[model samples]
Target chain A: MFAIEANGQKIEAKKGETILQTLTRAGINVPTICHMEGLLPSGTCRMCVVEVEGFGGLVPSCSHPVAEGMKIRTNTPEVMQTRKTIIDLLLSNHPDDCLYCARNGNCDLAKLAADNGVRDRTFHGERTHRPKDISSPAIIRDPDKCILCGKCVRMCEEIQGVSAIDFVNRGSKAYVGTAFNEGLNVSSCISCGQCILVCPTAALSEHKYIDEVLQALADPEMMVVVQHAPAVSVSIAEEFGFKPGTDFDGKMVAALRRVGFDRVFDTSFAADLTIMEEGSELVHRVQNNGPLPMFTSCSPGWVKFVEQFYPEFLPNVSTCKSPQQMMGAVIKSFFAEKENLDPKKIVSVSIMPCTAKKFECGRPEMGRDFVPDVDFVLTTRELAELFRITGVNPAAIEPEPPDNPFGERSSAGKLFGASGGVMEAAIRSAYFLLTGEELKEYKIQDLRGMKGSKELRVKIGDLEVGAAVVSSLGQARKLMDEIKAGRSDIHFIEVMTCPGGCINGGGQPIGADQEAIKARMNALYQIDRDDRLRVSHKNEWVQRLYTEFLGKPLGHKSHELLHTHYEKREVLL
Target chain B: MPTVKSVETILKEHPNAGRDHLIPILQEVQESEGFLSQESITKVGRALNLPSSKIFGVATFFNMFRFQPKGKYHVMVCRGTACHVKGSGKSLDMVTKTLKIQPGETSRDKLFSLEIVACMGACGLAPVVNINGQFYAKISPMKLQRIIEECREKEQTHANA
Candidate 1:
């Protein structure tokens, strides 16, 4: 450690650390736009400029290395003026439609501007009025509101490694665009919506289905049924000003009832249904000389990634539809029949902690009828806004149970919200099927946590079952490459497209750091530990459904509703 | 005339290239094909293990690489400080308006391509417009239009012959 004077206070700075890191370590609040922790500091935004004692010019604290006995003034008049000028210039070219923007009060740029006392635009010039891009089923891109901070650009490139969008043109005319300036649907975008999480403006966001969901709710002819994903129960609380790890599952069901949904169910039940189908499929593949190392297909982003880049692995992936899709089909088919209502008149809306779910529901193979499986998909953040507008506070309302039959889910289904949770759950159930005995203790620590890729091995009746859990498409690519390169030890893999799985999904609450994501993951694990029904096969209702309707896992009726196939995309558009 | 390598041939030479070789490969492709085609970009992206959008970003960052196919005669109107002072902006507007095209676009007849360059390091000939490496000094918008018509006439005569 070296001594440095930050804002006239003596502090010890770490070796080889930047001034920004030192200040951040000391709990100094320096506003930044383009400085991400893992990414290389481009210093293009000029928002973190600070005054150094010896330097003649203001330095970017993000990239500038800390020196011993160095005096750095973070909030000097000169630094303040420079930051204000930068903010003023950015605001001048901005769209000036804050009230209508998706990120109105939650914007990083607006927050920084407010902190720096930028009351009005000081400079005005010719602004680029680029058209909005809503071509993708999941995301919407408003080019005009983009401040060119390059956060979304770098996040899409460096983190996801998708490279669907990048900085096009040059200087002032420079904008983020796809190849040939084509719409996002024509690009290699997987509809992960990770870009929306990093954007400091309303330039990137998940496509809203709020209006359609409301219209369906208002219609007396339509019976609106809403379901919340497992991850949404844990993470949606963050959007409602609650603590990150708060479990709002019961309150969420109550809120959905208030939102005019005739039936509110838990997607966890469908997650349990997914495990039954997917786990059985894995077993059959292992026994019958079918495809080895069957990949999990719950995460829609991961499904698209495999379809686009690794088409050869289509046969290797489990044919089970995601929990959201399963819930949609089950609701419109089984639930509709139970209620003596027409499936066409029943509008199904799913609240997910994912942007990809919006795209997944509209897939050509998702539904039984001509219409989609799920009519509308809303992100957790979107649902939070609905709760806010309708005054349905989760804290204020009395907790209620979800609708019966599809509402009761095992703790194994709740674990589906986090990375490796699927593999852990599957292993528990797979062991029971192969050995006819429980594992005694359920928590598989090897498959838990926030690491991108993990590997674990277990034996079931002298048969070694090799399993790997991979989060993020980039990590999925790495593990797949390893497997293709003669690493045949892995017999099963669980892949979630977003980092840390659904807890940190693209459509979850914004401003969630690594700590917040870890908290949410731990909370899901806590729920699994506390709940008595920790295994999918142990769920009485699931067993009843299998016996009454589907017969057994991977049966004919199960194949029709719970399973689907994937095709290689021609242009990966 | 120099021998030009095909994009596939050029890509084959860089067998283990990654995203870093994107610019160098794009430069070679533009040099060979005169501009980056959508199909060629896709092919290059596959070779480099990068997305076409990222490749397009790299190709577009540099002003030299054009997106569309340039016509036989490339028309460059200088918008440098000296040229701007001499009212080259009006000439640029007039040329684009007449052709019903924007900067970096070809005429439907494939006779002329329009571009507004910053400077050609020739301030002595203020308000200069260059057509196929031949500089037309102190040219007005009307003069540029007449030059385009003459080029079209030459193409027509050559076709007849």
Candidate 2:
């Protein structure tokens, strides 16, 4: 480390780190817009400009290297003036509709303007008048509100490895768009919503279903039933002024009841069902000399990724429908029959931690007889908005249990929120199915935490089963290449499209940092540790469901309801 | 005349190219095809192991790249400082009115294409226009209309023949 004088303070700086990194490490505030944490700095937005002692002009601290004996003034009058000017210019072209925007209270540009004391429109220019692209069922792209910071573009290309959108044209005329500026539905977008997570403005957001859900709730003819994903219970507390990892499952259920849903179910219950089907499928494939290295199909984005980029591997993906679809199917078919209600009148809505779940439920193969199994999908952020609109404070409400028949879920099912949770859960039950005995330890330590890729080996009676878990599409692409190159040690692979699984999914709270994501993961692990139902096979509801309706795992009835197939999808890149 | 290579053949020529070879490959493809087609861009993207959006982004940042096919009589009007001072704006308007097409657009009959260039470096011949590599100096609105009419008549005569 070397010494540098920053804002009249002597600070130690790392040799190769940027000035922004040094300042951030020193706990000094330096505003930035386009500087994503793990991405290469483009320095497109000059919000972090600092006055260096010997520099002819203001240096962009985010891209400028820290030098020894360099005197930097971060909050000088001229620096503040320049930063304010940047915001003023950005606001000049930006639409002044924050009151009606989806990101009204949670916008970075608005926060920056407020922080910089920008009270008036200091500059005037021709505002962009591009129409919003709302063709995709999951995400919306408002080009008029985009400031061209390229955060969404970088997030889609660099992080997700899906360059569905990019900077088109040049200079002032440039904007982020798909190929040929076409609709996103026809592009290579997997609807992961990672771009929406990184957008600092209201340019990218999930397509909302709140109004439709409200309409369904108000209709006496419609019986609206909602299911919340596992990750959402742990992450939704952040929006309600609670700690990031606070589990608000019971209160969320109570709030949904107050919001007029006829029934509130847990997607974790369906996650348990998914494990039963997927684990049996894995064992069947292993013993019958079926496809080796079977890939998990729980993540809709990862499933779509394979369908588009790696169509040859479609057979390798497990046929089990995702937990959301599983719950939707059972709710419309089994639950409707049990309650003596018409399936057509049942609106099976799902609250998911992913935007891709919106696309997943709309898949033609996921339903039967013209009616969709799931009617609408809402993101965790949208759920929070719904709560606010109805004045139902989840934190203040009394905690209560979810409705029966699909309410009971194993701790292993709850673990599905984290990156490696699925592999661990599968190994726990697969051991029992093969050896008639449980593993010594339920928690597979190798398959925990937020690593992009993880590997483990388990011994079940004389057979050693190899398992691998990976999150994020980029890492999955690498593992897929290795598999194609004939690395044949693995038997089963779990892939989640988001970086840290559904806890840090695209539709989670936007401003959650790395610490918040880790907290959410730990919360899921803690729930698993505290709960007694740690295995899917041990869930009484799952066993009872099999005996009462489905008969057995991988049976004909189970095949009809729980299993689905994927086909090659052609998309414009 | 040289034989124009297909997009696939051009891509096959640079079998081991990386990202840095994108501009040269695009230039070569455009030279052969007159403009970059969506199919050609998609092919270039696959050959270079890049996404089509990124290829489109890079190709669009430069002014020389065109997305549409050029018309038979391509017209370029210079709007340099000298020409702008000499009322080339009127000449451009005249061309737009006569051809019913904007700059960077081709006419419906595929006989004329219009482009507004920054500088042709013909300050001595202020208000200059070029049609199929033939430069006309000291051009007026009337001169531009006559040139367009002559091109249309020539196309008509050639069709009749």
Candidate 3:
């Protein structure tokens, strides 16, 4: 470490660390718009400019390595002026419809402008009026609001490994667009929404279904049924000014009731159902010498990723529908029958921590007889907005349990929110299915936390089951290449499209840092630790449903509702 | 005239090409095909293991690449400072009006194509217009009209014959 003077204070700088990293470690605030955590600094925004002692002009601290005996001023008048000028220039061509924008109060550009004291636009120029590309069912691309920081482009290409959009054209004519400037629906976009998570402006956002949901709620003929995903309850608390990872499960159910939903179901229940079906499938594959290394089909984005990029692995993917879809199928069929209500009059809505869930529900295979299982899907952000508009504060509301039947869930089901949670949950139940005995320890220490990829081997009687868990399509690609190379050690693999699983999904609260994601993951683990019902196979309601309606796991009835197939999709690169 | 190579054959030549060879591959394909087609770009992307969006981005960044084929009469209008000062803007407007096609576009009949170039290093000519490798110095609205008419009449006479 070397000593450097920053803002007239002596600070220690680590070897080969950038100026921003060193200063950030010392608790000094340096504002940046284009600098994404854990991503290579592009230094295009020029917002983190700092005055170096010998430099002729302000240097971008994000990319510049700190030198010994260097004197840097982070907030000098000249540096502040430059930062303010950048915001001013960005705002000059930006649209004036912030109030009407989806990210009205949550926009980073607006916050940066306010922080830099850029009260008004100082530069005048001709604004480019590119129409909003509302082609994708999950995401909307508004080029007019884009500041060209290239965060979304880097996120999609570098992190997600799906370069669906890029900087097309050159100079002033350049904008982020898909190949041939075509609709994103035709491009190789998996609707993961990782791009939406990194976007700082209103340029990229989830396609809202809140209006349709509200209209359905107001309809006298429709019975609106809502199910919240496992990751949603823990993360949605952040939207209501609560601390990250605060479990608002009960209060959120209460809010859903206030929002006029006739039934509130927990998607964790469907997660338990998934464990039963997927676990049995794995055991079947292992005993029958069927396909080895069966991939989890729970993540809609990952399923689409396989369909488009890795069609050869389609048979390897478990045919079990996602928890959201499973819940929707059950709600539209079983629940509708139980309540003596017409399936057409029932609006099966789901609250998911995913944008891909929106696309997943729209798939033709997900519905039957011209009626979709899930009529509308709302992201965690959209759910929070719905709560706000309806004046229902989840924090202020009394905690209440979800409705009966599809509401009861095991702690293992709740663990589906995190990266390795699915593998851990499956192992807990898979061991029971194979040997008819529960593992001594329910918590699989090897398969926990926020690592990109994890592997664990379990000995069930004589058969040792090797399992692998991976999040993010990039890590999935690496594992897929290994599987394609004929390295066969794993029996089961769980893949989530967004890194850190659904807790850090594309449709989660924006501006959430790495700490927020970790806290959310920990919150799920904590719930598993505190709850009494820990194993998915032990869920009484799931067992009752099997005996009462569906004959057993992987039965004919289960195949019709809980399982589906995927076809190789042809995309424009 | 050289025989054009198919996209598949061109891709076969660069058997082990990676992302770094994207530009050279794109240039080779564009040279053979006259312009980059969606099929050719997609093939290049598959060969390089790069997304077509990235290829399109890189190709669009450089002005040398075109997406559409050039017409029979490729018109290059010099828009250098010297030519602009000599009323090349009016000549450009005249040509656009006569051809009913903007710069960097071909006419529907495929007879004329327009291109606004920075300079041909022909500043001595002041205002310059080049068609089929033949340069016309001191070009004006009337001169451009007469030249277009001459080309159209030549086409008509050839068709009659």
Candidate 4:
């Protein structure tokens, strides 16, 4: 390790670490993507160029190794010129598709291009044109919009350990894609959404559901009920000018009402209900020797990846629909029954931070009692737009309580937004259900926080239950791979698609740096702490739902409405 | 510890390659294996997922990937304004003929992949070639070829045993 003064800040960096890594670790982000932590530094973009005191020329900070006592100026005129030129060069080849581009409003390259004062894409040459690829069930790849930055390449090769795609050609003919231009859906590519998350352009983006949602909201005969995921509460506030990790549950409810949602429910309600079904299923599976390791199926990205790549492990996957879909089913069935609304006329909406939720809602398996469970899925961004277009300022809107039955939930439900939150919530309920007593230790502090990928063991009755938690779709791949290999000792696992879980979802407000993401994750925990009804099982509404309507967890009625099964995708690598 | 030239030296030697083609060369190197094993390729592929094979194909197919294994010594000659004005192309030709490989092709011994890149953006260092990550300025054709020979000899001695 060496210490250096960069931009008047003392930075301690590992030997051979680049200036960009040092600066990023020190929280001074110089725009970069081709320089992820583990990948080789390809200084082709020259975006991280910096001026040094002794060095006469501007150099790419991303490739330059840190040395002891190196005096570096990040914002010199020469450096700025180099950066501006680089941005101009990139913009020349970049397509002006921001308005229609899926990565619009969130792309790093677009943000930087805007920040760097790019007036035009100076080059008047013929634009690179390639067809859009939407064949995959989970992801879409548009070649014409690709900036050819290797972030996706590095993310796949170095991070996810799945070298499914790479830069295939060179010069004016260069492209980033699979071998022989194979469709991503057909290739060994796991639909982890990491590539989508890392792509600097709209070249890679999840299939969107904004149009379907818009149509549903416009249908006069339809009663569209929406539910926001737990993690969405922590992050949706960011879009409304609230800080990341702010628990804007009340404000989000207010915004949904203002957006003219017929009913704004909580997916946490279903997440709590998921615990009731999945937990009971786990106990049955364990006792019956059905599957040793029952993997959580909350993340559609992970589920699709597993179904496609590791089909042999299908038995291990929990059959319960993800809370988003589960809530959809319950909405159309249970809620529709209570309200005496025709099932066909009820359109259940989901406001999720997940791109895969769009895919999950369209699944043929989602229909129950002749009605498709969830009619429309909206990312947090789309929902925010609804509030905006409807002229509802979420910040100024008065906070109000949610509707009856599904409105009242627990802190256990709230924690479902963060990693390990689902596991913790489930254990809180399952342990008590088995022991026939409330857990005296209310704080299951063991399963909490942004610890990256973690594995913990706890004794539930005579059996030692091994549980693991992972955030970040890429990290989940590693955990899933280990579980598939039978090397993972965990009996149950929790996987959240985004890093820091829903608090830092892809559709959340833009510009959440690492610190902001961590802060929002903490806010979710604090929200859990402040709630009096912390355990999902003990929530009065949940108790009544079982005692008054559904009878018991995993019973015939609960299974019909709250619980569902997963279908095996026929694709194999 | 072999006699290695800097990245500048390799670039100076290869006359035909350019800045727009650097990514292709890097991609080719990575595709040959799973990753960019050499630091030169790593530096070259930074910000681009330049699998070496893809880079090589692009380099050769569109004139960019360096087919040569990067020697402990890489010598890149800048064909940018300063270097071009100072006869960087002539220096690159001299290195290429001496090494007996095209701009992107490596020697059979696997010691070096010659590459010609556009402006290092260092207009002051005309006719510049970075050898083994070190900058070598004011290099004529004769001087550039000698650096390649010296690096080749060092690799030969190391491999002889």
Candidate 5:
């Protein structure tokens, strides 16, 4: 380490660390828009430019390495003016629709301007007059609002390995768009919305369903019911001033109640239902010598990725519907029958930490009885906005339990928030189904944490069942190539599109750091450790549903309500 | 004209090529087919193991590649600062109205394609139009009409032969 003076304070700087990293470690807040952790620093955003004592020009601290005996001035008057001028030019050409924009208060450019005390648009120019692109089911692209940060372009190409959008045209005329400037639906876009999460402005956002959901809830005739996904409760708390990974499961239910939902249910309860069907399906496949490696079909983004990139693996994917869809299916069918309400009147909504769930709920196959299984899917941000509009803060409200018949869930179901949770949940019940006994330990340490790819082997009565868990489509592609090259040891594989699973899903809180994701991930593991029922097979309510409504796991009723099919999608038009 | 060679024929030239060679692959296909067809782009992506979106991104970024086929007679009217300061804009307009086609477009009869180029290195001839590699220097709108008619008459004679 070498000594460096930052604001007249001497500190040791690591050998290869950037000036930005060293300054950040010392609690000096530097504003940045284009720099994201784990991504190559482009230094395109000049917001992090700082003055080095010996250097001739102000350098971008994000990419410039700190030298020995270097003196850095991060907040000098000249540097501040330069930063303010760069932002002023950006704001001059940017659209002035922040009041009606999707990320009005959450926009990075707006926040930077406010922090810099730039109240007036001293430098004014022409803004791009492009119309908003709402062609995709889950995402919107507004070129006029883009600051040309290229965050979405890098996120889509580098992280997700889906080059649906890129820089098209030249220089000032260039903008992020699909091939041939066509709609995103025609391109190889999978509607993951990972781009929206990294976008510093409202250039990209989830297609809004707030208006439709609000209208449905206000209708007296419609019996609007909502379900919270396993990961949403943990991440949504961050929007309400709660620490990341702070579990507000009960208080969230109370907030939803105050927001006028007729009934609230837990998607984890339906996750238990998924384990029964998927676990039994795995057992049957293994016994009958079916496909060797079975892929989990919960994350819709991963399912769409398989459909577009790896169509051959469609058969290997388990046919179970996602827990969110299962809850919707049950709510529209069984709940309709029990309450004696018209199936059409029961508008099923899902609160999920995923933007892809919006597209999944609208799939043609998800409709039954001439009505869609889920009516509207809201992201955690949208639900938080709903609570704000309703003046129902979780902090002020008393916690309440979820409605019965679809409320009580095993800790195994709650594990679905993390990456390997699905495989772990499935194995806990699958081992019992095959051996007639539970595993010695409840928590499978092998399938936990934020590792990109992992392998675990569980021996069940002379049968060695091997499973693999992967997060991020890029990593999934590498593992898939290995599988195609004939890695037959893998039996069950779980893939989550977002890197840290649903807890760190694209629809979760934006600007969430690595620590935030880990906290949210650990919160789910904590819930699993605290719950009495460690396995899905031990959930008495799920057992009751099998006995009272559905006959058995993978049986007729279970297949009708829980299983779904896949189709190969055309790559280009 | 139909695509004489499949994308595989061009891709076979680079068996181990990946996404980096997308531009070269597109250039090869456009050279043979006279345009980058949707089928060729998709097939090139499959052969290169790259997403079609990335292929399209590269194809659209450069001004040289055309999605649609050009007309039998390709005409480029230079609009360099030298030509623009002179009277190339009027010449471009006259040509468009004569063919009833805009710049970067082909006529319905497939007789001519129009393009507005920044320069053709013939600024000595203040206003120049390059037609099928032959330069018509110091051109006028009325003279341009007569020159196009002369080309049409030559085409008719060639067809009759």
Candidate 6:
């Protein structure tokens, strides 16, 4: 703990806690959006400003740390007025159509406006109108509703480590978005959807594939198969007003069945497949020296981040497709083959906690046999909306089981939804594949848990495998800079665009504060520890998939179904 | 490059470069060499033990930093809310027309660099343009030509001296 005095208040705080954290812990509320305690302090939204006795002017309390004997003032009339003016300025360009907005009933920005008693748009001028970006399959961006508070940017940069969104200009004209207001579909944006989770308004939201799913259900010819990502089990219950970390896997299956989907599939099965492909890819890379840093491509945000900022390191990214995309490809190829249905007729719908999945599904590179692996991507909220549309009360539904083959997933596959789980799952399999011996030392200690940046080198037989894991894009930037400068010796890096992995993806349930998200992450980690079969290779279903369908990782079948390429494009509105 | 190093040396001698170095370093380099150069980035990186790419990354990332060298005289047009309401865009358009360069672009003659900044924290003055740190208030399209002619005269005289 660090000792510090702020505004004559003697306080003891964690050594690393920011001034905002110390102040908040001491009962002082600072106005800020991009500065959640668990997340990185963005310092982009400069609203939580305070006048330090020694410092000349007001400093942003969110990023600034308290010093010994420091004087801090909460309700200085000047500070209050400044805050009001900032809010007023933000409201000027913001859309007044909150009544019809998706987040009307539950918007933090709206609540702030009401709490502050701000009644008018003081700066009346010609609005800098930007068209809504609805190009992606999962997320939507209504620029008019954006306050430029930078919560979305921070979430993208810090939590996801994707760095997909950023400030384009300076001051009032400055807007938060991809390069030239390019739709997420075209930009190097990974579809993690963490940006949507932290956004204060409906400026960024999940693309509603729920409507498409409904349409498919309405069309009797469409055999709509719904797949739930592993993280969805712990989080989907929240939409039904159930507590976070609740295992609603049964309820989810029941809900999908009730909603009239032909099959309710577990993405965990595909996740198990990912561990096989990705884990094997890691070993192949380490052995053959294909790419030193084989980055995980599961998180779209990380993929996009690598594409935009670190294009030189693109080879480092694993060619293995994400679980959603892998499932989509297989559902179109293998599932369609096995079920005796045309690939085009099998409507593959994925229920994700990500907004980025919408964009990922629409990628030109995602098509195999001229059919996108996943036809539609819906966030947990959109699924909730679908539940409402179908008139299915999740609470009233009877718990059911997912269909066979794809339904058989180990806890290793289930853990893929969280941060460090991918690396953990991959190493569990990779260690065995490389050494031809059971890994008594299964845990890759360096690749477990969240920090600004993590780097480690481990010996796998004769080869020393180097790896790095970073949750936030800001941290990714730092790591990337290190890589660019030839400072990083890492080989197989696992980067999840979302901070706590897909469990805390962008399109998850709204209003999930720092504590709520952390609780969810902790629960997933516990599940990973509790599971008897914690290795992907140990999953019987995965072994069977390799034996029956896919011959090997990076093999012809694997490449056809589990690997994809990236294209660099200039983003335009 | 020498100019950037000199400025960095000067900054190293200053009191508070530890925490508030990046902005100050940028400001000093811009002052000494008319804008931030690739050389300045390398020097800063070497001095700070920060990566040269990181320094360049930070410079390019911020909107405030200017990458290319500018003209001897800097002409800035205010595009704040008050200024915009009073037709700062039209005023900027006129400046753009006369200078034969867009906002943020310097004239090939090295005589002027035109830029548009928001507000300048001066709202009461309404539409404002600053020439080499000297404020010109309530500027319209017609008044812009005279200002340009005056800047030309001042630059010519200063050069002669």
Model 1, range A1-573, lDDT digits (tens) per residue? Answer: 879999989888998999999999998878899999777899999899898988988999999889998999888788898999999999998988889889987999899889999997678788888999999989999999999988887877777777888889888779998888998887788899999999999899999989898889889999888889999989888887888899998988998898789989899999888888898899899989789889999999889888888899999999999999988888877788888988899999999999999989989999975967799999999999989877788877889999888989999999999999999889889889889999988999999999999999888888898999999888888888887887888889999989999999999999999999999999999999899899988888888888777888988888888899999976532
lDDT of 3 by residue, A418-495 (tens): 999888899899888888898898888888888999988878889888889999988999999998998999888999
Cα lDDT of model 4 by residue, A1-573, tens digit = 778998898888888777787888888768765666545788877788887778877778888887789888877677776677778877777677678776666788878877777676566666778888897655789988777888877766665555667776657777887644557765556565567766778787766666666687788998878888887777777777776667778888988877768998888887888888888889998889878688888887667766755677778888888888877877776788898999898878888877667777777777765567887777776777777667888778677888777888888888887778888888888888788877777667767666768778888777788888887656866777676576846788887766667766655555567777778778877887778887887778777778878888778887676655655564313
* True A-B contacts kept by model 5: 0.60
Error of 6 at B29 (Å): 18
Taking the candidates in order, what DockQ does each have? 0.66, 0.76, 0.86, 0.08, 0.50, 0.06
Give the per-residue Cα lDDT of candidate 2 at A101.
95
* Clashing pairs for predicted structure model 5, backbone only: none
Which ranges in model 6 have alpha carbons more than 4 Å from their true place? Answer: A1-19, A34-93, A117-128, A135-139, A153-174, A177-192, A287-289, A309-312, A395-398, A434-437, A440-446, A455-464, A480-490, A552-555, A566-573, B1-161
lDDT of 6 by residue, A248-280 (tens): 778879988988999888998888889888887
Q: How do all models score by TM-score?
A: 0.96, 0.96, 0.97, 0.74, 0.93, 0.72
Q: Best DockQ goes to which candidate?
A: 3
Error of 6 at A47 (Å): 5.2
TM-score of chain A, every prediction, order shown: 0.98, 0.99, 0.99, 0.90, 0.97, 0.84
lDDT (CA) per prediction = 0.88, 0.92, 0.92, 0.73, 0.88, 0.75
lDDT (tens digit, per residue) of candidate 4 on B98-146: 7777665666766666777877777786778987678887888888777
The runs of at least 3 residues in candidate 5 whose Cα sits more than 4 Å from the true structure, single-residue gaps closed, are: B1-5, B71-73, B87-113, B131-136, B139-161
The model with the greater TM-score, 1 or 3, is 3
The DockQ score of candidate 5 comes to: 0.50
**Candidate order by decreasing lDDT:** 2, 3, 1, 5, 6, 4
Residue A465 in candidate 1 has what lDDT? 88
Consecutive 10-residue window with the lowest summed lDDT within model 2 chain A = A120-129
Model 5 clash number: 0
Off by over 4 Å in 4: A1-16, A21-29, A37-42, A52-58, A71-77, A97-107, A117-122, A134-140, A156-164, A178-192, A473-489, A567-573, B1-161
- The TM-score ranking, best first, is 3, 2, 1, 5, 4, 6
Per-residue lDDT for A467-572 in model 5, tens only? 8999988889898999999889989999999998998887888878899999999999999989888898888888898888889988899888888999998766
